[model samples]
Target: MNDIAKHPLAMDGKDPSNLRGDPIDPERYYSRSFMEKEWQQLWTRIWHIAGREQQLAEPGDFIVHDFMKESVIVVKQTDGSLKGFYNVCIHRSQRLVWQDNSQKSFACPYHGWVWGLDGVLEDCPDRGDFPQGDPVGKLKLSKVRVQTWGGMVWYTMDDEGPDLLTYLAPTAELYKNHQFERTVRVNWLRVALNTNWKFWSDNFNESYHTRTVHPQVPPIIDQDHFTSRYEMFPMGHNRIIQMGRPSLRDRLPDGVPHPFDDALRAWDIDPDSYPDFETKAMQGWLDLKAAKKKLWKEKGFLHYEHLDDEELTESPFQVLFPNVAIAPGADSFLVWRWEPHPTDPEKCYFDQWTMAYPIEGQAEFVNRTAVNPLRLVEAELDFREYDNGAGVQEYSDQVVFQDWQLTAGQTAGWRSRGYRDPYFAAQETRVRRFHEVLNDYIAGNPPGR
Candidate 1:
């Protein structure tokens, strides 16, 4: 691995200078050709997290992923095995599935062609007259490599990319600490953006903007006494660890649960409507030290709290390159999925799966030991209105809007004569590392520093 400390932009004790210039023109990220090349060279050749294994909680349960330019379905067979295949009908190349729930077989909406959960041709209209000698024996949905980790289901466009663990090797140890298989509630969105996918990937890689750009989201928690750390994986994967906010139980009146404590916090309160107090006075401020001390003792945070200053300054912020972010915390975990736009490199879909796992003995979970992942069959959002006058998921929407406004704006500027090479932040080492690894990938050179 190239020593992170010696990289051209890595600076010790001071912010790196190489990264302090104008942000890269978002235009390059919006270019159609640039996106097309990235899709072929990077996305298609790597393992991408498809969905959660729990989604296929039972036999026949399945979810379809519109990956890159291809449609895929990951299904759980009756034998308790997992399988994936192109979501297209073998007959006329039409899509075979639309809904993400379970079915005995997938029947194409265009025609009545049906496929078994195992991707076998279970039924074909007028098959008795065909000379193809029973399409059942000759037709099977084209399959892809499917695997599980931390309870997340992943698939690759390539039949030959490294297995899930191998691709995640650089940060496997840290990821194992996540215990994803034990997680509870998970809700995801399929977001489409009008820019390159990397724009979203790099945005989540750092926290320097939390206090400014995302004041509402960051202010609810303690920002001090934490770390901001990152690890880059070959093949454009990156992980970010942002420190967690201190407990806010004391901020609430006695017997009232902290609003943010609920896994369904977003369902009740929109984060955008909340007040933005500085971290110091945000919650239980007068007695933060005492509150944290008592909360730590009761919650056992003191035990999991790392002694290393770096770990202390940061919480776990991990990004699976190309498109996926697993950001877990003691209170809740956020899983984001970035899907590509079918025709617009300047646009792609984005989804957020906000999950909260019950502590070992929380009464809400009657079967704490049994793997009973909560299912969210409905969302409370008014999608027709971006924020509906609030911004949590919409905050994410706003961020994407900000990105889109700029990327689209920059596309106009890419043609301007005054546009120049971009600069990055010293703290924004993740961005530099991104391009470094990206350049290597583009040149067919080895990944990792």
Candidate 2:
């Protein structure tokens, strides 16, 4: 039995009739004019993730999120609330802060103008020289709307747009079982990719490409489309939940060691207890869930207490509107965000944050997407330019690294003169639905108005 919710506000994501039959124009991927449309029509209207709630534990802690050409600072207020401000100083538009740090007040380096944690201008260097009547308490930074959910800090430029939870819809409600607040991010990485930002939006909308692009995943995540569940929310977000078992059609060779066995072993289930491979793949999955339910608390996985049977062993990937995709698995969570470049439409930045729950006495975890063992602690950000695969050499074994290798070729493919509208598979219905929603936003008729 699957745990896919038929939300009242969501459409049948597997049905192509739900889409507008919109042609995904190639220009939308790499044209400057199209990029300008996204900036004016979509970017300003959507809620953006600045950072995490854990980063703002103190009253004055702040995260400076620099997106394309715009900069924003989400600060923790003295009253224990969160507020966001455009990072530009009210005077001369100088940048207020360039990094994430804790401070009682922000002093602009341009003219030593001091701004309080609440965004009020506390002091100006030249008190008497201002022609606009000293401009201290009366002047303040421009405010942006800020909210938090799922341990993530969110902000929006459109002051009147829907709240974060409303924008997230059933997607937010579906993931209530996860204690993301207690999870520690082990890998904070950003890579400058050569492909457009929409690449990730499309790439994550379907499991069709996973068998080809990420071969190793089929054995662990059950990449068969028929076995997966797809959902499309009215707010432009999408979700796909695949069972935590090996795909029968994509089985390994006889001598090859299976990843599913390792997963079963981790939960105290004997892999060799099954008589056959098919029984091990099907019956073993149910047994694995039962084993986890029986051993979670004593095994130090307190977060599993509230999780349902499906939540304890399923792989649910959520695509949040236009740019963010997240996998809130039982043991690990991954947030994948991609944004356009400052000036070039052919390039984008990809952020990968790997978070794992803290199990008592467990210092390390098996990060399926990473090469190294992930420790249960927060990690500092590591930024790199792809440089045609020369950079991030240490992440060669990571699944995302394999995806990164396709950017150079995919960029060239998009600009091909022979390019035409894509003919998608049934499993890829959400890909077309994604572009249809983009059409809605660009047409000023976004869903969930």
Candidate 3:
């Protein structure tokens, strides 16, 4: 791994001594009161991703991001800037937009109030009937702080919260090489799961379960704890950088085709030339980096020009505080965001977006987490209920599908009388740290606030 020590904000996420050893209470995962506290203290104060900036390329394009009971609309302005407003009509409390699309102006369906692209009220019915004077030019949609970063549109409900870049901290600086704006979201999917949203935050904080739940990952991305580097930030986010090669601990049975072999051959390295499994896993990884460095431009992988050696062949999975995780690799970027359901504490929505750089001739991109091949274009939203694994049967091969299968059992375990404080592995230190941060937020002491 590169010298993370050079990054002043990076701390050893695997060290238990860095954490407060807070007991992860079971109630926080399933209790309505605890969920309400999170809604008031944590969710409202934090920045949220509305959608990709690519979705609002034109002046009047907009995207609606509904979180729990609140909804926000981020629109592209005529001045080539982005603006966000609470998705509610000024006259009445009706929602302004039902979905994401382009429009010349926002027309409230219940009333004839028309809000301009700039959010000012352009026209309204019964102009002379208002006792408080006409609301046409005087009334405007309530605004939220909007900003764009990494090709994403973000807004925060708390007017006093830290700015988007500051809240993200070193993470924003860490991934500066990635041209996220250049990639297209090939797969945009949201699945309703029968579990609390924190399940994803906990699941993504550690790779200890990958060996048991996602057996195929070790062959493609080394999951062995000793071979990986873990770093935690003071701002509550954490990341794990794993080797992008087959793990010596997880060797396939003799004569079975290795996925790493295909990766090596694609980069013009001969896997058979390594003479041994250990050599192929270690030295072959180094050779693959060299091959990419030498062949990237010729292969039309222009996006790799700014990538360093580590970014070229390693996988760094980042958990952005409470509920976002992203694996930004050389060829593809996989992002996951989990949001709490409006009323039910046990139900949550999980969004998965698979984005890929547009290589010259590649017509399709297959994300590492799933086998489904997606066309290389911006995809429309596809939403479904997990329905105990029946609604999303087409995505059964996905790693997230396997995780979703465990949600019900885990949810039950959390409520069990036998359940207590988690006996966490050293590698799972980030998991407990996440709870500590949540505790801080509920206690009115959120980090970076």
Candidate 4:
């Protein structure tokens, strides 16, 4: 009910007619040939998220994102701009850095050929010995295109593809109220899952599985398809604007303490005053919005000032084409990046970054999907193996943990001879759209070309 005006470029995401009725091909999930094709056609042509812009706050600070078999170094330059290059030394093609850190110049650990933060060769041990006389001051590391949006530093391997904003299209203009650059990431995590990377792409595109998988979420986030607005953009991006209120039908049992009540009381609305559960959910949701609009100034929620009624209390989860998912909510901005494993087609990596806007006096943030409340401070990256859910035991309470647990089953299912095309729900239309757009990319005619 609170959805804002839809952007002109948005397609009806709930309509399956927009898709080409592509089968959710099983071979694409397990075949090496399919994986190589993705690398050549899809992964090479699209933009990728390296890290948050805040990570490179000062000049010389750099972050290295290694995707599949390629690694790229993104550096904050002395001119206050960002630059990216293949993480390879010009001399002998040696890898320069393995991790992120600040450095005035990159010294090739293999042979000590020094290159400046600007990627220009500054020195070499045997300058006179080189037959290519005086390579220093002239030779430069190969550059990758770099850009920033919604607090993320993104780079594309393709030199000729669309710009970041153009690729992001109406999505950039849709959430202009959100000053995502102001948010602070409290959790930075990377986990290796033994499932095709597209599992996440298909999983996040619809909420049809939420009721069965995440039973606790229905009462709080409204899991019903009718109440949500699903939108797919022309550039293959998509969004689902779920009402922030509870599902009126998916009620908790009587005598069970409801989670929705807690939100009502926090917003100073008396949840007990409502005569019935439906009124409390339906009416209290509206009341909660009004209370927030009135109390936000004094309540330290300065981020709410420019947000619309929908943005103030709604959930809009976005999938940025091939791999990135971002939830730019009123209170938090969550990002999930799914990448294929280096060698294993059945393995993939998922990055979950929980970011929260800092309120004036609020020191700790309670993100709904995080395992626990986190202090409003930047957290260093924690990389771990899924190890069949053993390595990620600390994140057991996280909702993504449930999805991680299904990796083994899903991985085996993809390889089964009995595996056939999926019977998709209408709400899962974007899932089909994702694969069709991917098919277009492989055919050398990507959407919005």
Provide the lowest-lDDT 10-residue window in model 3: 1-10
- Once fitted onto the true fold, the runs of candidate 1 whose alpha carbons sit more than 4 angstroms away are 1-27, 109-112, 125-132, 216-227, 240-314, 360-417, 443-449
TM-score for predicted model 3 compared with the true structure: 0.97
Model 1, 338-435: lDDT tens digits are 76677776566667666655544343421111123434332222222223223334343344344444444444555576876545555566666666
Model 4 per-residue lDDT tens digits across residues 324-439: 89899889999999999989899999999999999988889997678688999998888999998899898887789988887788889988999899998899999999999899
TM-score versus the correct structure, for each prediction: 0.70, 0.97, 0.97, 0.98
CA displacement after TM-score superposition, residue 342 of candidate 4 (Å): 0.6
Q: Candidate 4 versus the native: TM-score?
A: 0.98
Could you give candidate 2's per-residue lDDT for residues 341-440 as a string of tens digits?
9999999999999989998898887797764797778898899999988989988877898889888777788889898889988778899988988988
Candidate 1: global Cα-lDDT?
0.57
Error of 2 at 6 (Å): 2.7
Please estimate how well model 3 matches the true structure, expressed as its whole-model Cα lDDT: 0.91
Clashes of 4: 0
Single out the weakest 10-residue window by summed lDDT for candidate 4: 1-10
Q: Model 2, residue 408: displacement in angstroms?
A: 1.6
RMSD of 4: 1.2
CA lDDT, every model vs. true structure: 0.57, 0.89, 0.91, 0.90
